[model samples]
Target: MAETDFDLGVVTAPSGVLVLGMASWIDHWSQLGQPLSERASAVASIGGGHVQDWMCELVAVPAADDKALMVRAGTTTSPFDGGPTIAVLEIDLGLPWAGTAGNEPIILGDLPVDRCGMVLGDAVALDSWTGDSHPSTDGLADVTYWGGYAEAAHLQYGGELIPQHGSHVRGWLDLPPDDAEKIVDALKAWEGDQQGRGVMVAVDEHTDFHRFNRASWTHPLRIGAIEVAGCPVLGINWDNGDHSMRHRGERRFGQVYPVTLQPSPEGQTMMRWTIPPHAPVCDGPD
Candidate 1:
């Protein structure tokens, strides 16, 4: 099995840069493709993380000798630096730590264990291929699910079929057909007019966050659960058949109206992102 037990001492030498084991090599996520020795130089360009840099390397024991196993071997005698003294980094690189295959299925090997790409094994993390992810990082919102698939009442825990997702929700996004223009127009209108508030929509938060500590090792990233049938039914994004019951309120089938936003003339900020009568998509149990 992959190991993730690193003993590196994490500290920020200066600024807000997080450092570990006295390593000048800032482990920035962008530097995930760089060599261990040169990674530190990339820190200035990439951002910092828990141990300061968000990206680092993990190597197996070279000689299997007591010193080598403990990373006591130096660069001259082993494939590591700082001899055994620096070898303690294995604690952070492997096993149940931030850069091992522990989080991802360990069947595939060769690549680093990380969430941005590999999880201990070589296979890519859950949604890295999805275009919705962060461009370079592939991470989704810290907590979300299908963007706006659940009715306002179902956003909290124990509302409806939230149990199907097991626990918490995040990562899925069901955008309107005209996602671009609508968002822009709404923003513009929100800036132009001041008026009474429209409506409020809230989705219960059932979150189960996984600490990013494995392959595809960039930062704290999660694949979060997906709710296939238990989402809310929005006329703008779904059909009448997709709903669990007859949704015959304000928003009818095939309507493409966006949630409007406008500032109140009475000195109040009004914001909303939904159509009316947005009911449960899968109103029934899973």
Candidate 2:
């Protein structure tokens, strides 16, 4: 990886600086059947919580030919709290390879192998922060309870709380398993393609949906090619927990149908689908 320049955003919440990476890498370690406490211990040994100069450095572990487990400076909202986005040292696990072709494998410079513990630590911290409780180690359990839910609700509700009086029904388009898999694979391939741009799932305008009391229209949901260990589905905004919903009165539900991936005029990869009638519904307080 020829030292590609990355924009390191300013550090806002230093204490809250976190470590996170692709779901593929996390699944790799978890599949090894390591105990959660042991995983957390390994991470702590590698400087998981320690910070320096507004950045945390760790050794890169190779995942494949073009990819390595490296730390890149970035920022994201703290899973512990929704507000005040914090700095993050993202682990690049090399899946859906972010680099272009014919480049040397991205490698961390002059770092001792012993420092690889930091990578493990970051991964453990991420699991803890998300409160997945996969291994449920002491001090790691319930570190943050469903922060994404609140964030998702806020994104859809347009407020900190879901309105007290309204009918809320989330709409989802049922895609055949094979079609969903193909779409996810295509999105990942596009992410790796040199000409590929950001992709999204464009909710069919003809579909009826609502969030709360309002009509609650939404922008296209961005597609993240990476898998989220928490939710392994291929649905729209699966990782972010932002699914489409509609007002009950506007509901013109349809049946499960296949979808095809198409490119928008804006050069973005997209898929359009009608909402299925059988959706999870939540009625607001009376």
On lDDT, the leading prediction is: 2
Model 1: per-residue Cα lDDT over 1-286, one tens digit each:
1113222121111121111211112123334553332332233123211112343432111111111111111111111221111111111111122212333212111111122211110001111111122222322222222223334323432122322212333322233334423433332333211453222222211211122211112211111222112211000111222222322222224432222222223322221122233233566776
Root-mean-square deviation (CA) per prediction: 25.1, 23.0
Model 2 TM-score (2 dp): 0.20
Compose the digit string of candidate 2's lDDT tens values, residues 96-152.
433224432332222111111112322323333221223322221100111223344
Worst 10 residues of 1 by lDDT: 68-77
C-alpha RMSD (angstroms) for model 2: 23.0
